[model samples]
Target: MWFVKVHQNVKFHARETTALRTWVPGLGGAGPRLVAADPALLAVVVTAVEGRPLHGAVLTGAEEEAVFRSLGVLAGRIHAGPPSPSPTAVAPVTRADRYAKVDRHLEAARPHLAPGDEEHVRAVVEQAVVLEPLPLVVTHGDFQIRNILLAAGGSLRVVDFERSAPQPVVRDLVRLPDHFDGREDLRRAFFDGYGRLFTALEQAHLATEAVLDAVSGIGYGTAHGDPELVERGRRILARSRAGTLCPAPTPPAGGNPS
Candidate 1:
């Protein structure tokens, strides 16, 4: 059992124990025994695992591919599971909600944006709003390196599902390639695995925007009263407008049509 001290009134012990009980069965893990819980503090006792996090920037070519493969398979399993009956009752954040939050941030920063950049942001926002909604599935609300734990023998585990909730299956896919920018090879591996479980244009669209929205949020958040990240977001938005940023279908062997 491991004890983690957290902010006041935020206890991880009970929740971790409960989560382990609810989610760890048949996974070859013992129940997480809660050692303590306090209303005025936050902490949890969990079965500690010995391993370092898989960082995108530090991974070798092969390692990177492996990580993407793992992510894809894991995401498929999670999404295929039954939907959370009461998603809204949980700490769920929808794509629209995230988009709106980012929009508000962009609006507040409009005074600092270049004219072209401002228009680009507006376009992306509009496009996102017009996309059709896909069927909701369980999502790992936050699926980033910091939350994925890599173990020996190529086995892995997903930690920190506090934000988990029912969302479009595509929402889960978006986290993959976006997390590793410019790595098309790794992206393909992830997509290949994802394709085995899910095959549909609508699902692909949901995943596509989820990634764009995530990237947009990153760029916008980094701007945070600054102009640099906002400028980056503008460029990304423009790319999206040109049809270059949307997820592309695998081209035929001869090559894609102009």
Candidate 2:
């Protein structure tokens, strides 16, 4: 068995165990399989895919469209799966839990934020707690480009569901664009595919709000200490507040479009 140790065990063991069981079976491939409860460590053992990471390499117009369409279809399938029952349930993390985590990080990085930005960040955090909640569904807790693996036969397998939990469908959607720095067209393709599976407005709304929650969380995480993360967070929060975040038209090259 070929061993590819990607990184140290950053996520918890139990969480890693749950993710492998939940996601590995659903992936398509011949050999690189997930090791079952390996005593050595909690990591997936899948036949490695052939494509390079989607970063730095801008997708050509056609490839970009294709990528988005493929992602949309895959995400729809994942979301369509029924939620696990309560005893074996993947519960959605509450806003309070999220806020508290962010609060701690912000306190640690107090000196880094500009005075005005600090106040804005506080307000964003407060508003996040009051947003309406979404119906729980199976969410890929960390669905981003880095986690998606594109294989030789055009097969795209999503990896690292360590954070997979019962979350709103929108939460899953929100992570898709983050890997691409908020690609609006890609987001549309994803939503279009998602729409085919979940046609109801209520379902879409639930997903949308869940995505917003994710955006808020990302903002909180980025703004905690890193300057680049802070800027990225500000952009996400601003676009979200203006109703231009999810399923909305793509913004202009470098500015938020209301």
Candidate 3:
């Protein structure tokens, strides 16, 4: 089956298809198998992932902890693997490089942003730029909740490798649902699987990533006439300024997010 992704930019489609074709062989069961990519059609064809997106999956209670633990182990294993060897491979990005990307997107969205929010972007950039460099890993550029799929036998299959690239593991870490601070059990299980300790600085780093993610979304939405995405971007910026984007998310009864 084909998992086609249509985008406003053909380059992005081509890039993603190329990434998938080059990387899927090494991804094993963690991702889909690439079949073919036609830049002319702006489409990618991959073997079907017979699974459900994690966002609507029935992972709760003990199952939630188990899934997250497996997720952590999955992340650790992938990050430990070698980077892709593509002719057009996107190299690892630096903290300053990420800040640059954020600036570019935020600037493009300036007209859509409130004057106060624009100012907040500037201030946040100043603080975010001082970050030190970290080691690089092959990142699933968009590893958020939606991209994950629970396959047969409760195995995980991550989709959408179009944005995959070499970047800091922190960039990869940003997408996992480890932010709800009060839910220490899930957090503990996730990190425990990855064999990592949730650190103060990495937790702090997420706020800046959230801001940039918002600005990037806003810029794309403004250009593409996606009002919902634009509105969401604005909301994220508002939260960033108010110090709420990464605030301890209210824990649910089951204490799970994906």
Candidate 4:
């Protein structure tokens, strides 16, 4: 059967289509198959995968580790693959481009931030922006566990492509801090499945990304009356200030799996 999606914005429509067309092949049946797309109508039809959101699901430690590992494999497969052949494919992102995005988010967050908070945020971001550029990959944009689906047979599926784009590999980890914060075993299991580890530079970049995410989350949540999200954002920002948002990067374990 087909699942129809109607996008309110043309850009989101395009990103979703381009991502599905360009990277679904690498997912190995873990992602939806695009059936048809109409740019003018801002809609697309895709083959539906049956499952429920994985968030809040009760599972043993072994089961959870397996889920995270499988997710890592899926993420690695798509990130290592090439982008779309279509001319309309999403453009690769550079560090400068990412910094610009952070700037934009910073502006939105400034009004919500307390006095001096914005400057502190800028200082932290500046340090990260000076790092060397990382290899770009097809990132899911929002890689939190809530976006994943668990099938009856225990297989995992990823849904939603509107936010997909070519970005630094660590960009996908921005939303994952909550999961791996104090869980080294799970983190190891995940990278084991992905066949690589975050280098020191990538770890620093991930921390930077998380800071931006937190500020943006605070701004958006406050504007939209989402206290829970705002609280979560504050917690993340506190961690960032404490220099604990992400673990210190370790030596490279290996290269990305082909």
TM-score on alpha carbons, each prediction: 0.68, 0.69, 0.74, 0.87
Q: Write the per-residue lDDT of candidate 4 for residues 11-115, one digit (tens) a residue.
A: 789788988878775776788999999998899999988788898799899998888788888778878777433555666656776667766777767766666
Task: Give candidate 2's error at residue 108 in angstroms.
Answer: 4.1
Once model 4 is optimally superposed onto the true structure by TM-score, how far is the C-alpha of residue 222 displaced, in angstroms? 2.3
lDDT of 3: 0.69
Taken over the whole model, the C-alpha lDDT of each candidate is 0.54, 0.54, 0.69, 0.78
- Candidate 3 stretches with Cα past 4 Å from truth are 2-14, 94-97, 107-117, 177-181, 198-204, 218-258
Worst 10 residues of 4 by lDDT: 249-258
Q: Which candidate is the best by lDDT?
A: 4
- Winner of 2 and 4 under lDDT: 4
RMSD for all candidates, in order, please. 5.5, 6.3, 5.2, 3.1
Per-residue accuracy of model 2 over 180-240 as CA lDDT, tens digit each: 4555566555555454433344333533344344435445655565455455555555554
How far out, in Å, is residue 55 in model 2? 2.5
Each candidate: how many clashes?
A: 7, 5, 0, 0
Give me the displacement of residue 229 in model 2, in angstroms. Answer: 4.4
Over all chains combined, what TM-score does candidate 1 have? 0.68
Question: Which lDDT value does model 1 have at 129?
Answer: 70
lDDT tens readout by residue for model 3, 58-129 = 656787777777778777876776665465645555677677676689778988998798778778878866
